[model samples]
Target: MTAAHRKIIHIDMDAFYASVEQLDFPELRNKPLAVGGSEIRGVISAASYEARKFGVRSAMSGKLAIKKCPELIFVKPRFDRYKEVSQQIRAIFLEYTDLVEPLSLDEAFLDVTINKKNLKSATNIAEEIRRKIFETTGLTASAGISVNKFLAKIASDYNKPNGQKTIRPEEIIPFLDALEIKRFFGVGKKTCEKMYHLGIFTGSDLRMKSIDFLEEHFGNSGLHFYQLARGISNSPVVPNRLPKSIGAERTFTENFTSIIPLQDKLKDVCEEVSIRLQKRNLSGKTLTLKIKYSDFTLQTKSTTLPYYISSYDLLLDTALDLLANSDLKTSVRLIGIQISNLNINQKKAEYVQLKFRF
Candidate 1:
């Protein structure tokens, strides 16, 4: 019901960070560039289209990336500049519709079914937004238009880098049927292998199987596969879907049994969470500590404070106390710290001096 007769558009910026770098430094345009540190232990945050030609990609180790392209230029990320551009893009989206769901700093979903511009064609809106992005930020964005969010998102990737794709309702079935199983939204490497072994290589093959059979083979995920194969997705385009919680987690190569080592890990997790909160301009009243034993069993403990907190020291202290009071019968392989009940629009007066137990 949520997907019926709806018009959704997904807009994704082309090589956002790298593109921004190129825009700021005109000499870098049309050249191989990556945004990240060039340290031995560093990884690429983003790569320019030129660098991508040599198989250089974001998240790859700097050493490996440089091996692929010796001419790759590394530039440190300037998040503040990216945020400013994101705000500008969001402003353009709000001019046409209030139903804008941002996926990240450089991607978003816009529901223009009943927009302020009274536009009938979602494709037209997508083009206008793409044009505006280029004009305002000097960056190109690709777009996908369809009846639902799932289809729209996938279609957006069909034509990369300044292109747009539209999947009409009538064409959805054939489009999906021809699509490889690996291209489905939730199908990863393992899932693809499983599907291949089960003789399901494409959407058409998946469509031939009964929901019961698929579910029995893939567990709950089979239901999603079954629906997707039929081009049936009813997910909504939710607006202003702020994160419920913010957290940082780490899994150790070696399990830890001692309280001292675990406490040190907690400090790192808490610091990461605090940094994320500050970047988002958020504060939270609840603190949660999570632990995963070497055997994969998970346990979590949480407490609420009387006032919002965003300080690194406070978060670290609270997380450490939570760890101290936790059930530590087994060695932990993974640990995390999270904060919930966030106030994205927090005021200075919201902070209070109150000591609460973890």
Candidate 2:
């Protein structure tokens, strides 16, 4: 017999950036717009629903999107403002249950089987959260509720823009059997092509493939697909789990052989990393600097800081120092800064103050 069902709800805001823009400026309420850089070489971060109807999409090049829809209005992202909204929504989720795991600035998973309200059904809790987000933020959120996180995530997208759906335990079998193979979590474009060639187009088709054959073709990924097709996933909804690492990276469209441009890029990455670490209430003992060559070979150099390092100027200087000592043979394609061995501790000990570099 199967174990008792667990309640999981995945909440995702609809076109978060675009919606926020709409909320602030009522003039853009029904107009099509996108959020991203408006420069010659930039991509769309989010597109309003009206823009999406014209084939405008997030991550599409700004030039291409404009070609698709001539009236596409582009706006720059205000990350500080977005971060504020994220915190507000998170606070809303916490009010219902602490088992809330944020997937991004606008998406989260909530386990509400036995919530603060002592709710007995995931569907009821999903409705309440969705309603509250709209009430407080004036933004629409779609919600999916199911017995597991995987199904719940997919269901949230089933109906979007102020929608909510529930997949009860008894509905799991039909839900999996009817789900498209491409809709399976983590199945990318390449995996879909492989599955299609194997004559697996649906959950039923995937269910028929032997686990061994699937694994032989796709390696460990095959096992995950097999289980998902059969409505089996053991992944938990981890809540408020602090990050283990913080890193920043940048990909340059043009390869850089000059030292000036490389340093500029490194400085940019270090600043981003420092800001991220501070926002998360974290500090790291180790710093790693990474580089990718034009030919795609990767190299990294690291330093164990005498103490936790996070200030922007200090990190940039350290990364440059590390780069100076490394062997370089190719033009750089990408540069990055990473901090690891993360912990919440940041208070300096009295002993450290007495003997610092002394």
Q: Give the range where candidate 2 is weakest over 10 consecutive residues by summed lDDT.
A: 349-358
lDDT of all the models against the reference?
Answer: 0.89, 0.83
Pick the lDDT winner: 1
TM values, all candidates: 0.79, 0.83
Count of clashes in candidate 1: 0
Clashes of each: 0, 0
Measured by TM-score, the strongest candidate is 2
Tens digit of lDDT per residue, candidate 2, span 1-358?
1223678899999999999999988988888899984535456899999999999999887778888888888888887888898899999999988888998899999888778998787788888888888899999999998878888888998888789888777888788788898987778899899989989898889988888989999998878878888677767788876777899888776788877798888988998999988787666778898988876689999998776666687778778888888787798877898999776654652112222211
Cα lDDT of model 1 by residue, 282-346, tens digit:
88999999998866689999999888888888898888888889979798878998899888655
Residue-level lDDT for 310 in candidate 1: 86
lDDT of 1 at 236: 80
Runs in model 2 lying further than 4 Å from the true structure: 1-4, 249-257, 278-314, 321-335, 340-358
